[model samples]
Target chain A: MPTVHVQLFKGRTADQKRAAAAAITEAVVATLGGNAATVDVIFHDIERHDWATGGKLWSDQPPAPPTPAAP
Target chain B: MPTVHVQLFKGRTADQKRAAAAAITEAVVATLGGNAATVDVIFHDIERHDWATGGKLWSDQPPAPPTPAAP
Candidate 1:
C-alpha cells in the first residue's frame, strides 16, 4: 500500500477540493494500481506563522491569494 | 482559503479513508474556521523507490504496515 502526502499553502474552493480529491483518487487507483479502498488523504491548513522556507516564516512573506492553476 | 495536503505510505481501508476525510474536514472547518468547500485532501501511495528520508529511499527501509494510531 502506498500513502501519498502533499504539503502546500492552502487556498481552494469546495468544488475544487472535491474535484481534486476525486481526480487524485482515480489517478492513484487506476494509474498507480493502488486499491481504491486503501487510499487515505488529509489536508492541513497552515498559518504563515507556522511555515518557514529559506529561514523565513511564511507569515513574513507577502499575503497572496490562491492560484488554482499552479497545482 | 487554506489548502491542506497530507502524504503517507499507503495501507488503509476504504472505511478508514472516509472516516479520516470526514474527521479532517470537520476539524479544519470548526477548529480553523476554514470553509468546508475549500478543504482539499489528496493521497499518494509511495513506492519504496519513490519516497526518501534521511538519504534513504522508503523502499530500502524495512517493510512495515500502517500504524493507524500514530496519525
Candidate 2:
C-alpha cells in the first residue's frame, strides 16, 4: 500500500481534494505498481502561522502571490 | 531539513499536538543528526471516512476501543 501525504496552505475546496486524490492515486499506481484502491492520499492543510521558513513564519512574511488558475 | 508527516484520527487537543511535536523533534534530532528547528512535524488529522484499511473505510468499520491514558 502506498500512502501519500500532501501538505499545502489551507483553503482548498473539496472538489480540489477529490481531483487531487484521484490524480495522485493514478500516478502512484502507474509508477509504483500498486492497486489504486489501496493507495491513500491524505492532504494536510497547514496554516500560515504554523509554517516557517528561514526562522520566519509564513504568516509573518510577505504573502505569496496567488497560484494561477488551472486551465 | 527532515520533514515528518503523522496521520492519526482527528479530535486531539492542541496540548497533545505540542507534546507530540516536541517528542518527535527530539527523536529525529537524536537518531538522524538533524537540527531540531529544521525538523518539521506536520500532523494530518484524518477523518474516519477518509482513511481505509483492508478494503473498508474506517468510518464504515466498528468503533475502535479507546486508548488507555498514559501515566
Candidate 1 lDDT for residue A5: 47
lDDT of 2 by residue, A4-68 (tens): 77788887766666667777778778898968788776767789999999999999999878879
lDDT of 1 at B28: 47
**lDDT of each residue in B1-71, candidate 2, tens digit only:** 89998889898999999999999999999999968899999997897655544334466669989879777
- Candidate 2 ranges with C-alpha deviation above 4 Å: B1-6, B11-44, B48-71
CAPRI tier of model 2:
incorrect
lDDT of each: 0.55, 0.79
Best by lDDT: 2
Taking the tens digit of each residue's C-alpha lDDT, what string does model 1 give over A1-71? 44544344565457655655554555445433446566664544456687786898978988655333431
Give model 1's docking category.
incorrect
